[model samples]
Target: MSARPEQREDRRKDPVDAIVDQWAAVRPDLDTRAMEVFGRIFRLSRSMGDRMEKAYAPFGISRGEFDVLATLRRSGEPYTLSPRQLSATLMLTTGGMTGRLDKLERAGLLRRSPDPHDRRGLQVTLTEKGLDLIDRAVGAGLAVQSAGLSALDDEQVGRLADLLRELLAGTPGADH
Candidate 1:
């Protein structure tokens, strides 16, 4: 015997619902439909970010460092890109990128050498160690994410992705 629809609905109410109810009691004219949606999104992002950080921990890389290595690994054969290109692609400041590059290079995970095409530029390339690490780290991260989405069936996941994509596309400053 399953619970009634109204009973299920009551069980689904979360912290955001409580907040909305509080607002409603004080301000009946206020509309909180968007609040319910974004509040859950924010909470989900925070929780998943923590989980991802833990997933990458055993690889000796923080989530940000994992992103740096993953970026190079995804760049195809030779796994090289100019520092400027990396900064632009990662949407990170040049100084911030330099720090990550320095750390990775020191770890023997990547190397920096003068760009043959441009004397003033340097190229960053993933070493065999970096390549191996990213491959494993990516799998670990994906497993965490997959587990997180296990509650949703494939169809629901696809629908959620499409809706989120549409919402992100419409958001200002979210270009690309």
Candidate 2:
């Protein structure tokens, strides 16, 4: 059975609705169409994350592990990156990142070695098996992403991407 529709009259029922109400009262003359677009984008981001987590589950890896592996894979340098570097690139707390590294090490997907340039530093490198595993996991993840976008036609997808890029480029302090 289809899910029951929410009551349409309840204008302030959801968080977005409440925000709209507040903005309508506070700044009635300002343009709010951008806010609507961004609000849906924010919600879509959360939904996308959940779908990505589900996609990674079959690889027996958490989202954190997948991110680390992907970073090393993309680094194009023997799959090695210092823990501090990884933390900075991944925007994770150093302590939390250390724990992820430890977990990956325990899983035999990565290893730590003394950094040649620094006496007190270690570089985390992926093993051969780890590379193979991540390769498969990445393929699966791409399939999931493709499935998620199946509803959009080729032209729609391209247009959406271009529009999103334009909007993203204009955001203050946006990540390049």
Candidate 2 C-alpha lDDT tens digits along 91-117 = 999999989898889989999999999
Error of 1 at 117 (Å): 0.7
Point out the worst 10-residue segment of candidate 2 by lDDT. 1-10
Please report the TM-score between candidate 2 and the true structure.
0.80
Q: How accurate is candidate 2 locally (lDDT)?
A: 0.84
**Candidate 1 stretches greater than 4 Å from native:** 1-11
Q: Looking at candidate 2, what is the lDDT of residue 89?
A: 91
Tens-digit per-residue lDDT, 1-176, candidate 1: 21111225546778888887777778767767788789999999999999999999999998889989999999998999998888888899999999999899999999999999999889999999999999999999999999999999999999999999999999998765
Q: Stretches of candidate 2 above 4 Å error?
A: 1-30
Model 1 accuracy (lDDT, Cα):
0.89
Cα deviation at 98, candidate 1, in Å, is: 1.1
lDDT of each: 0.89, 0.84
